[model samples]
Target: MGGLTTAAILSDLGRKVCVLEQHYTAGGFTHSYERAGYEWDVGVHYIGEVGAATRTRKMFDYLSNGQLEWAPMADEYDRFYVGDKVFNAVAGKDEFRNNLIRQFPNETQAIDLYMRLLDRTGDALSAFGMGRGMSKLQRFAMKPWTAWKLRGAFRRITYDVLSDLTDDQDLIATLCGQWGDMGMPPRRSPFMAHAMIARHYLYGGYYPVGGSWRMAETIIPKIQAAGGEVFTYAKVEKILVENGRVAGVEMKDGHRIRCDCIISSAGVDNTFSHLLPEDVAIKSGYRQRLTSVTPSMAHLGVYIGLKGTAEELGLPKTNFWIYPGNNYDKAVDAFMDNPDAPFPVVYISFPSAKDPDYENRHPGTATIEIVAPAPYERFEKWREETWGKRGDDYEALKEALGSRLMETLYDKLPHLRGKVDYYEVSTPLSTNWFGGYQRGELYGLEHSQQRLKQDWLRPKTTIPGLWLTGQDVLTAGVTGAMMAGLITTMSMVGARKMGPLLRRIYA
Candidate 1:
């Protein structure tokens, strides 16, 4: 999306542009597919920082030529199901905190602290995102400021945040209603990353109108209007190099497209290790550090084409985050040893939940997805086939897991049992294929304080004229990736001028 969004922006700024995608469609995870009259979003659980005057909202409006509209999640924004206790994650910050406090009246002080953390974290990010992408000297000067703000915020991870926020293990789990956004358990995730999403939902999460696909589609025309092109099935084989700098890109069919520069949202390793020459790789130390870095988390998703809207089935529009009552972190480990292990953590969302008009998009149909942490190794046996193409073992495994997952969903909302009309399962293997992720890795780089704090991963690479973008730089998600586009575009233009452009972006 960073690549596409930036292409749209620059192309609009009058630079010729072309997008190279490995897949047949645009919008990596945001891409959706139609199956038996129902469509499902591969990602996009919920979007934040999209309110009026918000950074994400401004960027989207700018890139989409001002045609995009954001749809707030229906009433009761999000619901957390910790065992049988239900907590409503409302939209406004004070309202949200009050909701949590209402449930756990005794821990009012803890709620107060959590609210402060969310507010403070938002202050830092707003400063960082909209206040000029700091220059080298300014960045150096700002390091202490950044460090001071993040001292406790990013150091301990979200797990520690939840743990500190509430001693009630169940509520601790409940507060982490959307950990799936970052694949890793909160224990390893940077608190800033967690807080951003916490802040997004606190405004109450919203979705894009006309499907999440509209994000790319909206910007696409602007790229053309800027005299550029976005085409499906156009695959980039290698980033063309000239004098140790990016010259253009060579397609799989051996066609060369020339450009003055190359910006890649393909990811860190793929851009550096696969596209650009390794010998001239920028920041060898940074590359070495990433080699030792851990991936955030991958997901095993089940897509169901339900027979009716969630409302008709008596389901809540708000998502249901279900997790095992205890021994939470072990669930990820259990998957590596056993693919068939009972998934302790799962999330279910009916895209049609937010809009009744969805039925107009696919009459009498709704799409719901169930997701859980998945180890890449679990699908190693089926890795041989092309991505997105599943074989026998793949189908069998999917069917089995899909059924078991259905049972789990039924346990929470029994009305869903006979509600599904069509179903399919997607594993890490599918993501590896369609998403171009290595080892079916989800969420660009893992969300760790160590990874998030490292300065090397920022856009500029050692290779001249080559740049990295997407979730690798920013934490993965709609708003973060969109910010990645803003930051990467600034780098391509030169980091020194990043400030003025950001001021304009926010202005």
Candidate 2:
């Protein structure tokens, strides 16, 4: 999405852009796949803040030329199962607050305080994003003001900040239930990250009208109309650097495309550790800087196909977040320490239920996706093996994990146990095989407090003629990456030009 968004925007600006996607299909994580007459989106589950003509919706409209459409999820978009307790988040801001208040009447004061913090964090987030596109001089000049805006919430840990508001661990867990959206537990994540995600979904969640793949499908025409092309299976072997500047990219097939300027949405780790030359990475200090951040959590994906339609199967549009207990940090730590421990968090999404057009595409079939954190080390030994040909031992391990995830699904929706037609499990290795993350990272870099504090993780890089964007540049999710694209364009083209362009799109 980051790459496509940047290309589409630049294309609109009359700069023809070429998008090289190594995968057989484009859309990065937004891409969808088919198996046994059923389709499932890989990364995109549900997006928020697109129910109306908000900035996010406008950006989508502009990029897709109004071709892209959204289908609003249920008013109760998210359902959290914290152990034996059940909590939910409703659509409107007042409804969400009242729902929380109803759940914990004693925590009204804390809930109100949290809501105020979320409101205040909105401005801080805007400032943080704007600061990413600024030059060193601009950022330096604005440092005091930016720091003041970001001081308390942005600098503090999520758990610490929430704990300050209330001592109720269950309330804290309820507030932090969606921590998996950013791939960090409360203790490790910055409060700003939590607030940004919470505020983003204050309205509700929306699914693409057709499918997630429609995102790239719709945006591709805009790029093509402007004389640009999106090339799939175009694997880039390395980024050609000449005298500390980007020259072009060398394809895996020994073909090279020369361009002075380059914007890498491939991710910070991939750009520095894999694509760039060792000497260049060392010279640029990215080699040492790389140690400051770590890859985000890897995951196991359980894609299930059922015989009946979503309506027939009683699938709800609300996403289910299942937790073993309320101590998110402790649960994560235990699971990380021992693989045998119960999963810290398991996120289940009913794609067929969310997308109103699903039945038209795959008649009488429903798709369910279950995602849970998995350590890369568990599958590291087979990383060198081929994708589908990873030997019986690997297949057995995947089957075991897949069955366990199926039980988790059945535990919630018990009626569907015997109705599954087919299912497959994808390990982190599958992420590397398809998405090209070496460590099979679900999100690019971990959204830790320290990682979020890094000033160098922006669109404009110290390397001349080279820029960075994507989830690593901003936060995570489709919108975050799309916003990174906007920021990257604003950085590439001066504010003088981008200002009018923004007005044309958002106004």
Q: CA lDDT of each candidate?
A: 0.74, 0.93
Best by TM-score: 2
Predict model 2's lDDT versus the native: 0.93
C-alpha TM-scores of all predictions: 0.93, 0.99
lDDT of 2 by residue, 177-264 (tens): 8999999999999998899899889999999998999999999998998999999999998999998899999999999999998889
lDDT score for residue 380 of model 2: 97
- Between which residue pairs do clashes occur in model 1? 159-186, 201-204, 282-462, 296-446, 387-433
| lDDT tens per residue, model 1, 1-507 | 778877875775567887778788888888877778888888886787676677678888877867878778755777766556666688787778788888888888888888888778776765545323445776787777766765666566677777866777656665676766676666656777777767777777777777878778888887888678887787777887777678988887998888768888888777766666555554345446667556656778888887776667765567777765544567656765776776757888877776555777887677788887777877777777764566677777778888888887888878777777888888888887788777777788877777765676777666677777788877688777778777777766665555565666668
